[model samples]
Target: MPRWFNTAGPCRPDIHYMLPALRRLPDVQRLIAQEGYFVVHAPRQVGKTTALLSLAQELTAGGRYAAVLVSMEVGAAFPQDVGTAELAMLDDWRNAAEAQLPPELRPPPFPEAPEGNRIGSALAAWAKAEPRPLVVFLDEIDALRDETLVSVLRQLRSGYLNRPRSFPVSLALIGLRDVRDYKVVSGEEDRLGTASPFNIKVRSLTLRDFTAQEVAELYAQHTADTGQRFEPEALALAFELTQGQPWLVNALAKVAVEELVPDISKPVRRADIEHAKKLLIDRRETHLDSLAERLREPRVRRIMEPMLAGLALGDVPEDDLRFVQDLGLVRMAQGGGLGVANPIYREVIPRVLSSTAVASLPPQTSTPWRRADGRLDMARLMEAFLAFWRQHGQPLLGTAHYHEIAPHLVLMAFLHRVANGGGTLEREYAVGTGRMDLCLRYGPDTLAMELKVWRDGEKDPLEEGLAQLDGYLAGLGLDSGWLVIFDRRGGQPPISERTHASDAVTPAGRRVSVVRA
Candidate 1:
């Protein structure tokens, strides 16, 4: 039987083309050797479970230490009922140990103990009864919340001292976030102000995303198996789109091979990759849908709203920023500013965010925006957008999740309608950069655009916007484009009065269509 890309769960070496698990996580063995208790965190589907599971098998097979990987996710089902959570968790650990370890290394039945102290007492019993020292990896530790999470952490902390005899010699808490980022909310609307109970952690390490070389190697496995190759451009484009997100990396390849080019004799190309990307986003797969759900979170909004709007993120709490970063929604950009993690996410975020507004658009109205030759007529599109801004923009703004970026969303929604069937719309926006750049591609034409906002307290952005768009256009090797400035000043004129369109020449003599709305 042949193997394919695995996206739904941990990659099995026999069935999946995966990087060497231990090679990716070199520090785990060292940390265990030092008798340390630590935390390992990474974004979802980055292979935390796969790495630890492989390490456990390798350690137990070495004939020195007994090791097993267990999960605390069952405890999350009973958040306030610590007793029940403990019992379920212990039962799971026993089953996991039985399946993964040999008879000599398997733990004996857990000793009876009270609800809150059950995990600690059980670990003590296992360590004392077993001949070999025990090392345990506790996965999904962050899923438990409120009293349950606190109780589990306190038990692990309490059992930290009796290493090598009465307690596990080394333990690892594995989850989507570091120890400090866990929120223990016990009935209060806000998190507990008390200090964290799991302070025994020696270090908090995160799993890094795959590098470009790793991506190429993984793809080569497919080529070696099926005698089908991915074009060099497609390979590089895959890395650029996913930025080494494990799920996305596998998903793109799976879609391209399994869906786009099912015949093994044919090679995958960049165009096929683009088609797969559109399909994935349009279908809203579970991974992408889950990310969209996080947009409603208050902490997420504080960071993401400004990012999409191309506004400066000011006075955001550091913890909130770190929390989003850990979730893999954002990353540090090339010049030290924070932005969306990758191009795929950059496309997914706005499309998901503006989906509601897109749905609200008028149905199938004919327009002169597309010429007889199937090219997008920029002047006509701009004129139609100004009319739309006057008629429906305010209502759409009122319904937007991020008020600061409402106009931007409304415009994107409109352009999406324009480009949905025959063309593509690409967006570029970042923190500390006060303008959003857009590239709209129709059959044979490319339209470059920049968006800015003019607030009441600020001076007119016309001169600055023209200058910025000039630089943006130069980079794209384009001579002319659009500069859209939205008027957000308070006590301003009516929408119909304020919305207008004109043209200007940039300092570099490139003609810029300026739309003031």
Candidate 2:
């Protein structure tokens, strides 16, 4: 059986194998034949290196070109010292070349250089001497220092015109970001334009996560080999939770096959997939850890805060939006808006970002608050939130998303504490929606709430609140609804003092209550 859960690097053919992106291969081949420099970027572990390596092998197998894959990732560990970094990179390249190439085709001893273009010159010399067309795959190209990166890219640029006979005919720079954004700085404080060094790049390709169908195909391979069938619903549930991220898809399957299923003859079920998701989340696996780390970055937060609040803005530039999208932070909704990419990301984002705050929340019974009838008591939850805001809201406002339509995070934290083990809260938020709808699924009942904060001195919010609550309650198939509106206006009276009014009845004949927090 093949091992499919690969977290370290490119998938090894002898261990874990994958379906080739045949549709992309023709384009890659065309670029190589045209002697073009190109880029392949994707979120980490989306199979960029694996695809490039497979493409390199295909090219070399044709006997038309000699292909080599070298990683510059190690060079990045030592920054500011270009000389030592270059030597380390060159040594790495030589070792990889020696390992991949056959004895008869191995090049002569690598050249020695004290400084100036050692790597570039050595590679150019080797390509010139080899009879076959040379193709090079530079993995993790972003790892090189500013000076080292500039030197390497400039060398490739200078050698581009002398392809097939004088220098490498095809080159690929693979990393997390696009080559165009790469900024290389020289020791003399001169900045080399990214476009100048990699000007020959004709195209950039990104390896996307698998679709639902593709995820099925991957798991079917294991079933074919072992006669262990995955229940149909298991695959669907996996897709729902993971959204077909390659790593999570594989990890979930590994857990199901190795841990959940007691015997090879038994079929994997939805329960198995659910168990796998919980195990992964509870363990806080490395992949999840790395993903959580990105949530704190200011750029990432700018895109995420709005989505969390269900009010995505449209003023950001295309590049910034694309960068976030490329990182798998958000995806385009069916109606042409953006939303969190998947359920796992949605769940992980809140827990990771507000871990500190969640920890500080007082225990459920410790506070002077308790939900009557074992439900998320909106009255008590909101009171606690208002008290928290009165003390910490201002200090946190700079970091808090006050500009958002609904501060679902703060409210969710309060409810999360109250409903810690007894129930689950499901949140639905999307970019450009301008509202957040939360459903607290408790035993034998459900509570539907629409969270919105008043801004700019709006006096009577009852009508707007009713309309929003109507939509939320209808979707949830509930009769009664709660619209918790934050009174951002100063000097607002307490909930007891403010009028508790009911708007027009919903279709189910249940009235929607508008409450001020």
- Every candidate's lDDT: 0.88, 0.71
Q: What CA root-mean-square deviation does each model show from the true structure?
A: 1.9, 4.1
State the lDDT of candidate 1 residue by residue for 171-254, as single tens digits.
Answer: 999998788767687321244333778888888888878889899999999999999999999999999999999889999999
Model 2 regions lying over 4 Å from their true place: 1-4, 21-26, 114-116, 183-196, 312-314, 363-406, 442-445, 457-461, 489-508, 511-515
**Which lDDT tens digits does candidate 2 get at residues 429-475?**
77656567778775666778877766666656556667778887877
Weakest ten-residue segment in model 2 by summed lDDT: 185-194
- The C-alpha TM-scores of every prediction are 0.96, 0.85
RMSD of 1: 1.9
lDDT of 2: 0.71
